[model samples]
Target: MEKSNANPSIECTVTECEYHCQDQQYCSLDSIRVGTHEQNPTQKSCTDCESFELKKSY
Candidate 1:
């Protein structure tokens, strides 16, 4: 999947975190897994992400 050059126009509260989507659909940040936050299943907020890493395009 390629990184999206198309701006999602969405701003995430996780300021220090970098995020990229796979095929421009799903966030591909390997630093944290999606299902890890079982307590807050509906919580998509990345503000609490401690291991967030940015994805670079080649």
Candidate 2:
């Protein structure tokens, strides 16, 4: 498959995630959905990556 040149990049330190490309801190997915755990999120911790998938194998 041809890699999309326009893939939006976001720094990801969660190496345990499946979308995290090996050796790189960038997310491999084309898009991600960010959602807050609470209705009134005031901190970055409140945000969650709904698109995050636990890596079955690393």
Candidate 3:
């Protein structure tokens, strides 16, 4: 896999995300899209990372 520069401002722990920096607990993208699944979301669990993409296995 190719190494990616981690965005210092964006810390992440989802290793399954394609945009996650392979060498660090951070995201490589310049920005990310966050959304909510519920119409009246009121908690952290209701939120979702819309930018998430499954990492392709080779």
How far is each candidate from the true structure, as Cα RMSD in Å?
7.8, 3.2, 2.1
Ten contiguous residues with the weakest lDDT in model 2:
1-10
- TM-score for each of the candidates: 0.24, 0.79, 0.88
**lDDT digits (tens) for residues 1-58 of candidate 2:** 1222223467777778777765766777788899998989999999999988888775
Residue-level lDDT of model 1, residues 14-53, one tens digit each, is 4333465444543434334433446545555533454556
Better model by TM-score, 1 or 3?
A: 3
Q: Against the unseen true structure, what C-alpha lDDT does each candidate score?
A: 0.43, 0.74, 0.86
Off by over 4 Å in 1: 1-6, 20-33, 39-51, 54-58
Ranking by lDDT: 3, 2, 1
| lDDT at residue 40 of model 3 (Cα atoms) | 100
- Writing each residue's lDDT as its tens digit, candidate 3 over 24-56 gives 999988888999999999999999999988998
Cα error, residue 11 of model 1, in Å, equals 4.0
Model 1 lDDT at residue 10: 36
Of candidates 2 and 1, the better by lDDT: 2
Higher-scoring candidate on lDDT, 1 or 3:
3
Indicate the TM-score of model 2.
Answer: 0.79
